[model samples]
Target: MSRVAPQGVLKSRRFRDYLFMTVGILITAWGLDAFLIPNKLVAGGVSGLSTVLYYTLQDKGLTVPVGVMMLAMNLVLLVVAVSFKGWRYGAKTIYGMVALSVAVDGLAPFTPHLASHDPLLAVLYGGVVTGIGMGLVFKARGNTGGTDIVAQLLADRSNFGVGQMMLAADASVTLVAALKFGPDLALYGAVAVVIMGRVIDLVQEGLSVEKVAYIISEHSDRIADAILHELGRGATGLSSRGMYSGEAREMIFTVVSRRELDALKALVHAVDPGAFMIISDIHEALGEGFKENGV
Candidate 1:
């Protein structure tokens, strides 16, 4: 598992990662420029602060591109990240940051403004798109610079969850934005962040949310095989015993998507009417038919 690739191959893979990160940056920039910027709605994080500053400066007749501000802020955090976290930690971050900064600036020129009358609709659209872009960057093993670096470092040194740390940082930025953008805008930003948060989960986990099925039946083998052949999903058989009856039996475990739920249930019931089954939601079902390797 701890193997290093050849230098040439490593460089090639690095380039590919950079390419994907660039696409993510471009998509993120388009979302911001088109939906969020036009409607004065913001999500949390470095991008959110940049949006606030962009409009703040706009009011002062000074034109500072949001991307440029983002780059500057990220550079400050990048330096701090490297100073404490080490060079290797910041290397990919630097590459991602620079590429994202440039892509955001470059793509802004071409991105169309949605100019939607409803601020809520714009927030939803922008949040989802930006979340997708961020998810792609994460999938490529790239960083988004700014507070992500700081949050990651902090999360690593403590028992806190990374998501929680990130949320704290993002909420702080939105709070600051509120002081300048007004209370209502702040609330709108929060709503946007909520939407974006969910979208990021969906993108990273794959949209095909699954349901895990646990079966306890007399003929567990038959049900498991049916699930495997009919549903194209793997099933595990476990040794289980009846608590009250003092009899041993086999239990089956399988995961399938929402569309396959009815079929899976039907299959188990058809095989054994007395089959006991449990189903639960799977937030992220990676591997196999889920997210592809290296993505």
Candidate 2:
């Protein structure tokens, strides 16, 4: 297990985390108010169920706010988290969940019903806004305190990864939505979940999607130099023996942006026309010329 940092250091780390959490909360609230609530659209998690129930009751002439239902469902999930994961895990989640609930309720009055009849537009916009919010929360290492905690715990105890577990859990909810709201709404909800998950991954990875280039060439030095000078990126040479040739060779390794990828290939081709190079996508790049530490 990873050790917890000291209280002071942890507090410093939490400053940015809290800021992101607030941003996430606001975004989620907007999504609920502007899209999901107005259109009676159900998403994937507890929020989805809350939306479903809100509309169901409203159809029967009862008026219960979705925000209230969201809070109640999250509180119930918090209890489950405490029982299964203990107080330490539950503490952070409780804070985040409560804060989000309060923000949702507070923003409720300000959010006007704009597109109550357009389900497609509601799903599109709601999914995007909610996805952004979910991404922010994930970047802060905080769960939305929905079925996410349960999914994570199940994943840890089972053979599945967290992502897989989340998919399974959300799938069950989606199935219920399909039974209740028909296939179209369920399909849209599934799309929303997938989009939301992908956006979360992208945001957590940050803006580091550089391309890693591996060059096996005779003119390794020239290629390396070109990468350094032209691409403004660093290259490292690794000594390796070719299995087929049984001779030692210097392999050049470097990372460059997707935009600079063509330039890098051109540089490599210019330096050594016959150089063997492998290029792969890098989801993130950090340090030195890239995203600096503490920035």
The candidate that achieves the highest lDDT relative to the unseen native structure: 1
Residue lDDT tens for model 1, 1-295: 7666689778888788778787887788788888987677768888888888998999999999888998999989878777886786646788777877777788787877784787777888988898888777887788778777768878988899888888888889889878988888888889989987788777767655689988999889889889888888899988888989989998898888899999999999899999998899877776888655552
For model 2, what is the C-alpha lDDT against the true structure? 0.80
* Segments in model 1 whose C-alpha atoms lie over 4 Å from true places: 1-12, 156-159, 225-234, 242-247, 256-260, 283-295
By TM-score, the best candidate is: 2
Q: The CA-based lDDT of model 1 is what?
A: 0.83
User: Pairing residues by index, what is the TM-score of model 2?
Assistant: 0.88
